[model samples]
Target: MTALTERTEVRPSSPSARSPLGFAGLIVLLVLTTLFVIGLAVSFGSVRIPVGDVWAIVVNRMLPGVFDVWWSQARESIVVGSRLPRALTAATVGAALALSGAVAQLVTRNPLADPYLLGVSSGAGFGVVIVTVLGFGAGMLGVFTVPVAAFVGAMVPLFLSLAIGGRYPQPTAIILVGVALAQVFSALITFSLLVLADERQLGSVMHWLAGGFGDARWSTMIFPVSALATVGTAMLWSARRIDVLQTGDDGAAALGMNVPRFRIVHLLGVSLLAGAAVSVAGGIGFIGLLVPHLAGYVVGIRAARLLPVAALLGAVAMVGADTAARSISSSLEVPVGVVTALVGAPLFVWMLQRRYRRAER
Candidate 1:
């Protein structure tokens, strides 16, 4: 047995060959895919522009000297001023949530986990309700109040869950505690909406809860993009530790890793990603839960490879969902969250069934 183990170790498969691409290739592909998807998403809406026109608009704006003759004020306004920012925001938020979910699942070692499973979304919703329903949007103070309230709301449940679940020991117990806190916060949100908000105010509150890209202004995109870049960089840097942790806590510790410290750092990063996403997107669901799992199944369970692939899949999913939400009805645009749920529910079930079948086999 000792000789066999030594032989296996000596002939161990190269990690580079296993992934079929270096880190540079992965990054370049991710960037190209992101740009392509963003362009596709921007060109599509209630009023569809031809693919040629889409590229024309993008090239004319991005490379004026190269495509100066293709410039048009009307097209640029429609694409650049309106659709481009919204599409980019959607991609960034989707990628952030998916990556956060991936990291959260790794840190918690819970198959059923998601970034916002710890009551983060509920907290953000509660914050938005307090600001919008209380008639605070018109004031100068209200400018930063919504996001501030959301940040506080997100952190509250995270710390509360940690406190209730005890120290960094049992992942299952921690997950259960998070679920309980989520339920409590969700109930609070419902009660506030029902008791404090009037009928007129309730309409706006419901709209926000349903989630849409309609609010994806330049100002709103700043925070989400900034948060995504920062948290994503941290996650990427810690990817190898995540892979080690997947081998079990004892295995990770035996390999000279500080398991507890790694978990804390990953948890904090995911929380920041989740909070910022919830603040901007207003509780878009299923992306975090579904995207990471899908990426794992498609690529592999290794967190390092799964991270960028999950981000791409998430961007594609959200951009497609948002397009459907806008184009589904001529008279009204459906909420992007509703569209995601409609599509994601069946896909999620299919994935679970496949996993079960594989396990049985």
Candidate 2:
């Protein structure tokens, strides 16, 4: 049979099984759910807006003149200026984290790997601490200092990892180095908090480390979304090469793929994506590790197909988690990172159990 016929035969036949419609349907459901969650999530917090008012605010801003007759300026400012940016920031950051995780797993061939496994998050944290303690993130300089420090922190480890690894470095070795560096950075962060930071500064650092979108502003949204768009586009362009690389280096070499070049390109892409994410979001965890696995189970392991679906799922997961973080308690707003760990740890254990059972069979 021809290649076309072979391809056709390999695919499932039933519309339910074969057509991407089901996946498309899931994407649609996820999008709607994300919108609802954002609406509900915005209506929550210390000052609550009723659901109806929240919806009206969103509609008036989004649709402009269509709802101008009934629009309230105060409500519009709350939803459009405050909550909307935070919600979108949460969604975008989550998607970037998830996509980064998926790429790391594929590149390393390790199930446990996430964006933080490379020391990126810890490094960024250290950078932020340094700026904060040194008094650079104060007075007139505070606005731009944190993100600049964070970006530097993220880049250091990424470049170091690439340098230390040389050609064809083992994935396990890279992760080991990352863990060590992360520990070292964490110690520095603790030292800074103890020695230099005042109580208020320490409190601010602690809060940032915990991770939330409460500080998110329209300006904060610009960098990450721009980075995601550019880097995500690059990843999609090279999706076929990434898929080939998944079949083992030797297998990829045999297929005439330049394994090293492919690896470097993709790693750089992930570093840029992860670094940008850390610069803004302050190391929210697990969206990357959990979302990709969930997406793969739903959409199969084909990298080309998996990338976009995983991104969408990641966005859904992040938005949902952010909503839960704020609404779970009346008096306390839970950290986004903590919420993600709560959900991810249990899911990971379940996945491990399932894998072990499959192995036993």
Candidate 3:
């Protein structure tokens, strides 16, 4: 068979699936839900500020001297100083991860592809571990140490996969390579922490590896926000090209698109996004894997349609998970990754089963 004839096929969504009104409503609903979730997340930390007061404090801070300071200094500090940043960080990290997942799915043409699954998260964690072990505080590199390290680490697997898979590799080959690399990186992280880290450092690294937003602050938000804005926008701008690429390399080349160049740029974009999420949130899994699939159910499989919905859903899930982590234990905060894994694992299995059933039909 010719290259085009040998390509794997993907069925496009039916005309019934295209509904602009429904898409708009979904966006509006998700936006409102995101705001509500952020408010709820800010309201229910250990101190327990009211939801109404949380928004008021936010407005007061933004428009200072407008709303009277009815809330105490302590309450204001908790709302604006601590909880708000954490909540927003979760939202931003979630969106970045989801976008990365959507892009991974598109490029690999694999529903199972995700940053976490492909070892990108493990690589990022390894980078963070290296910095921590070396005692390389943010002094020299400033706030960029973790993010830079993470992006570098993330690119390793992506680059390796591209090289191993060749100019036009199969999806299964890329997935296997990613899975193997992920396992190797994860083992390295464990070995390094066990061998090099002190007691306090070990505990800290372990918590971060488990993933939570506790360490989040206004300063830490820069990497994720900027990454999401820049890379995410670029991906959306190239959505039609992504749609073309989905038809396989031969089809894309026939359309006069540069297939290899497109994949390289977008895959690097995906790495940057995943690295940003891991830099701030620390090895949170499933946001990337789960959110895109969930969004596709509502918005269909087009990149342009999937990206926005996935981002919003991811933001909601992360913020909601963080809130649950805090509320789940009065004495100790649960890791946000644990909550996502618990929810995601079951959903993933169901999705797999649903796919099988459809195939059998």
**Model 2 misplaced regions, further than 4 Å:** 1-21, 46-56, 137-142, 167-175
Candidate of highest lDDT: 3
lDDT of 1 by residue, 1-361 (tens): 0000110111112345134565557657767877777777777866667667887777766777665555467766888789988888898889988998888766766656678866778877777777777655534444456666666677787778667765757544445666677777788879988999889878877887787787777777877789888889878888888888877778889999987767766776787788888777778888988998887755566777788888887887787788788889988989999998898889989998997798799
lDDT (C-alpha, whole model) for all candidates = 0.75, 0.74, 0.80
Candidate 1: where are CA atoms >4 Å away?
1-31, 136-138, 141-145, 163-174
lDDT of 3 by residue, 260-357 (tens): 67776776688778877888788888889889988887778888888888988999999999999888888999999999999999998899799789
TM for candidate 2 is 0.88
Clashes of 3: 0
Model 1 lDDT at residue 62: 76
- The candidate 2 region of ten consecutive residues with least summed lDDT is 1-10
RMSD of 3: 4.0
Question: In model 1, what is the error at residue 321, expressed in angstroms?
Answer: 0.8
